[model samples]
Target: MPEPDEICGVNIAFAVVGSKWKPTILWVLAGRPHRFAELRRAVGGISEKVLAAQLRELERDGVVCREAGAGFPLNVRYSLTPAGVTLDRLLEPLAEWGHQLQRGR
Candidate 1:
Protein backbone atom coordinates (compact mmCIF):
# COMPACT_ATOMS: atom_id res chain seq x y z
CA MET A 1 0.00 0.00 0.00
CA PRO A 2 1.18 3.50 -0.80
CA GLU A 3 0.05 6.93 0.16
CA PRO A 4 -1.45 9.21 -2.45
CA ASP A 5 1.61 11.42 -2.41
CA GLU A 6 3.91 8.49 -3.02
CA ILE A 7 2.57 7.70 -6.49
CA CYS A 8 4.34 4.34 -6.81
CA GLY A 9 7.08 2.07 -5.56
CA VAL A 10 9.59 3.45 -8.04
CA ASN A 11 9.05 6.98 -6.86
CA ILE A 12 9.34 5.93 -3.26
CA ALA A 13 12.59 4.09 -3.93
CA PHE A 14 14.00 6.99 -5.91
CA ALA A 15 13.06 9.39 -3.18
CA VAL A 16 15.23 7.44 -0.78
CA VAL A 17 18.22 6.85 -3.08
CA GLY A 18 17.97 9.30 -5.95
CA SER A 19 20.89 11.54 -5.17
CA LYS A 20 24.03 11.56 -7.30
CA TRP A 21 26.22 10.19 -4.54
CA LYS A 22 23.69 7.92 -2.85
CA PRO A 23 23.98 4.94 -5.20
CA THR A 24 27.75 5.18 -5.29
CA ILE A 25 27.79 5.45 -1.53
CA LEU A 26 25.65 2.34 -1.24
CA TRP A 27 27.84 0.51 -3.74
CA VAL A 28 30.98 1.25 -1.76
CA LEU A 29 29.33 0.34 1.52
CA ALA A 30 28.15 -2.94 0.04
CA GLY A 31 31.72 -4.26 0.12
CA ARG A 32 32.06 -3.75 3.86
CA PRO A 33 31.85 -1.27 6.67
CA HIS A 34 34.06 1.78 6.37
CA ARG A 35 35.07 4.69 8.49
CA PHE A 36 34.19 8.22 7.48
CA ALA A 37 37.60 8.88 6.00
CA GLU A 38 37.64 5.59 4.15
CA LEU A 39 34.24 6.21 2.69
CA ARG A 40 35.26 9.68 1.62
CA ARG A 41 38.26 8.29 -0.19
CA ALA A 42 36.33 5.44 -1.75
CA VAL A 43 33.62 7.70 -2.99
CA GLY A 44 36.01 10.19 -4.50
CA GLY A 45 35.08 13.52 -6.15
CA ILE A 46 32.48 14.24 -3.47
CA SER A 47 33.18 17.01 -1.00
CA GLU A 48 33.30 16.34 2.72
CA LYS A 49 30.22 18.44 3.33
CA VAL A 50 28.28 16.57 0.66
CA LEU A 51 29.40 13.17 1.87
CA ALA A 52 28.46 13.96 5.42
CA ALA A 53 25.11 15.28 4.33
CA GLN A 54 24.39 12.25 2.15
CA LEU A 55 25.44 9.80 4.86
CA ARG A 56 23.21 11.51 7.34
CA GLU A 57 20.35 11.33 4.91
CA LEU A 58 20.94 7.63 4.24
CA GLU A 59 21.14 6.93 7.94
CA ARG A 60 17.95 8.81 8.55
CA ASP A 61 16.27 6.83 5.83
CA GLY A 62 17.29 3.59 7.58
CA VAL A 63 19.46 2.51 4.67
CA VAL A 64 22.74 2.90 6.55
CA CYS A 65 23.94 2.34 10.07
CA ARG A 66 26.55 4.28 12.00
CA GLU A 67 28.37 2.61 14.86
CA ALA A 68 30.69 4.39 17.22
CA GLY A 69 33.42 2.39 18.89
CA ALA A 70 34.20 2.93 22.56
CA GLY A 71 37.64 4.53 22.59
CA PHE A 72 39.49 7.77 23.06
CA PRO A 73 39.76 8.36 19.31
CA LEU A 74 36.08 7.45 18.99
CA ASN A 75 36.14 5.32 15.89
CA VAL A 76 33.00 5.56 13.79
CA ARG A 77 32.08 2.99 11.21
CA TYR A 78 29.38 3.01 8.55
CA SER A 79 27.74 -0.07 7.11
CA LEU A 80 24.68 -0.98 5.16
CA THR A 81 21.61 -1.80 7.16
CA PRO A 82 19.56 -4.87 6.25
CA ALA A 83 17.41 -2.66 4.12
CA GLY A 84 20.47 -1.18 2.49
CA VAL A 85 21.88 -4.58 1.71
CA THR A 86 18.64 -5.51 0.02
CA LEU A 87 18.72 -2.26 -1.88
CA ASP A 88 22.25 -2.90 -2.97
CA ARG A 89 21.28 -6.31 -4.26
CA LEU A 90 18.40 -4.78 -6.15
CA LEU A 91 20.75 -2.27 -7.75
CA GLU A 92 22.88 -4.98 -9.33
CA PRO A 93 20.75 -5.12 -12.47
CA LEU A 94 20.94 -1.38 -12.79
CA ALA A 95 24.70 -1.49 -12.41
CA GLU A 96 24.97 -4.09 -15.15
CA TRP A 97 22.73 -1.98 -17.35
CA GLY A 98 25.00 1.00 -16.83
CA HIS A 99 28.01 -1.07 -17.81
CA GLN A 100 26.26 -2.21 -20.95
CA LEU A 101 25.34 1.36 -21.81
CA GLN A 102 28.92 2.49 -21.30
CA ARG A 103 30.19 -0.27 -23.54
CA GLY A 104 27.72 0.65 -26.25
CA ARG A 105 28.83 4.25 -26.18
Candidate 2:
Protein backbone atom coordinates (compact mmCIF):
# COMPACT_ATOMS: atom_id res chain seq x y z
CA MET A 1 0.00 0.00 0.00
CA PRO A 2 1.28 3.46 -0.83
CA GLU A 3 1.96 5.78 2.07
CA PRO A 4 -0.80 8.39 2.30
CA ASP A 5 1.57 11.25 1.62
CA GLU A 6 2.97 9.47 -1.41
CA ILE A 7 -0.43 9.04 -3.02
CA CYS A 8 -2.60 11.48 -4.94
CA GLY A 9 -5.50 13.08 -3.12
CA VAL A 10 -8.09 10.65 -4.57
CA ASN A 11 -6.09 7.62 -3.56
CA ILE A 12 -5.61 9.02 -0.11
CA ALA A 13 -9.35 9.43 0.20
CA PHE A 14 -9.91 5.90 -0.97
CA ALA A 15 -7.37 4.58 1.49
CA VAL A 16 -9.43 6.00 4.29
CA VAL A 17 -12.95 5.01 3.18
CA GLY A 18 -12.35 2.30 0.57
CA SER A 19 -13.14 -0.80 2.55
CA LYS A 20 -16.50 -2.54 2.01
CA TRP A 21 -17.58 -2.13 5.62
CA LYS A 22 -15.98 1.16 6.52
CA PRO A 23 -18.24 3.35 4.36
CA THR A 24 -21.38 1.69 5.63
CA ILE A 25 -20.15 2.11 9.16
CA LEU A 26 -19.46 5.76 8.54
CA TRP A 27 -22.78 6.36 6.79
CA VAL A 28 -24.77 4.78 9.60
CA LEU A 29 -22.88 6.64 12.27
CA ALA A 30 -23.35 9.84 10.30
CA GLY A 31 -27.00 9.68 11.22
CA ARG A 32 -26.37 9.60 14.96
CA PRO A 33 -24.40 7.74 17.59
CA HIS A 34 -25.41 4.12 17.74
CA ARG A 35 -24.73 1.18 19.98
CA PHE A 36 -22.81 -1.80 18.62
CA ALA A 37 -25.93 -3.84 18.04
CA GLU A 38 -27.61 -0.94 16.25
CA LEU A 39 -24.68 -0.60 13.90
CA ARG A 40 -24.67 -4.31 13.20
CA ARG A 41 -28.34 -4.19 12.32
CA ALA A 42 -28.06 -1.02 10.26
CA VAL A 43 -25.21 -2.56 8.30
CA GLY A 44 -26.80 -5.88 7.64
CA GLY A 45 -24.75 -9.04 7.04
CA ILE A 46 -21.77 -7.88 9.10
CA SER A 47 -20.66 -10.28 11.83
CA GLU A 48 -19.95 -9.09 15.34
CA LYS A 49 -16.21 -9.78 15.20
CA VAL A 50 -15.79 -8.02 11.87
CA LEU A 51 -17.77 -5.02 13.07
CA ALA A 52 -15.63 -4.78 16.17
CA ALA A 53 -12.43 -4.94 14.17
CA GLN A 54 -13.59 -2.35 11.63
CA LEU A 55 -14.73 0.01 14.38
CA ARG A 56 -11.29 -0.30 15.96
CA GLU A 57 -9.63 0.55 12.66
CA LEU A 58 -11.89 3.55 12.13
CA GLU A 59 -11.11 4.73 15.64
CA ARG A 60 -7.40 4.44 14.96
CA ASP A 61 -7.86 6.43 11.77
CA GLY A 62 -9.43 9.26 13.79
CA VAL A 63 -12.64 8.98 11.81
CA VAL A 64 -14.76 7.29 14.43
CA CYS A 65 -15.26 7.92 18.11
CA ARG A 66 -16.06 5.11 20.49
CA GLU A 67 -17.56 5.75 23.86
CA ALA A 68 -18.41 3.41 26.66
CA GLY A 69 -20.14 4.05 29.91
CA ALA A 70 -19.19 2.46 33.18
CA GLY A 71 -22.13 0.25 33.99
CA PHE A 72 -23.12 -3.33 34.65
CA PRO A 73 -23.55 -4.17 31.00
CA LEU A 74 -21.23 -1.86 29.15
CA ASN A 75 -23.05 0.65 26.98
CA VAL A 76 -20.79 1.30 24.02
CA ARG A 77 -21.61 3.78 21.26
CA TYR A 78 -20.00 4.87 18.00
CA SER A 79 -20.13 8.24 16.26
CA LEU A 80 -18.23 10.08 13.57
CA THR A 81 -15.59 12.57 14.53
CA PRO A 82 -15.35 15.91 12.73
CA ALA A 83 -12.93 14.35 10.26
CA GLY A 84 -15.41 11.57 9.64
CA VAL A 85 -18.08 14.14 8.92
CA THR A 86 -15.83 15.72 6.33
CA LEU A 87 -15.26 12.33 4.77
CA ASP A 88 -19.00 11.76 4.64
CA ARG A 89 -19.34 14.95 2.62
CA LEU A 90 -16.52 13.93 0.30
CA LEU A 91 -18.21 10.63 -0.43
CA GLU A 92 -21.56 12.18 -1.28
CA PRO A 93 -20.81 12.62 -4.95
CA LEU A 94 -19.69 9.04 -5.36
CA ALA A 95 -22.87 7.93 -3.66
CA GLU A 96 -24.90 10.00 -6.08
CA TRP A 97 -23.09 8.43 -8.98
CA GLY A 98 -23.93 5.02 -7.61
CA HIS A 99 -27.56 6.01 -7.35
CA GLN A 100 -27.57 7.16 -10.94
CA LEU A 101 -26.01 3.92 -12.05
CA GLN A 102 -28.62 1.93 -10.15
CA ARG A 103 -31.30 3.95 -11.88
CA GLY A 104 -29.61 3.48 -15.26
CA ARG A 105 -29.66 7.22 -15.72
lDDT of 1 by residue, 1-105 (tens): 767775777787898999899999999999999999989999999999999999999999999999999997999999999999999999999889989999999
- Highest TM-score against the true fold, candidate: 1
TM-score of 1: 0.87
Residues 1-105, model 2: lDDT tens digits:
866765787776787789999989999999999999989999999999999999998998899999998997889889999999999988889899999999995
Off by over 4 Å in 1: 1-7
Instruction: Tally clashes: model 2.
Output: 0
TM-score to native of every candidate shown? 0.87, 0.84
lDDT score for residue 87 of model 2: 95
Superposition error at 15 for model 2 (Å)? 1.2
lDDT of 1 at 81: 99
Cα lDDT listed for each candidate:
0.95, 0.91
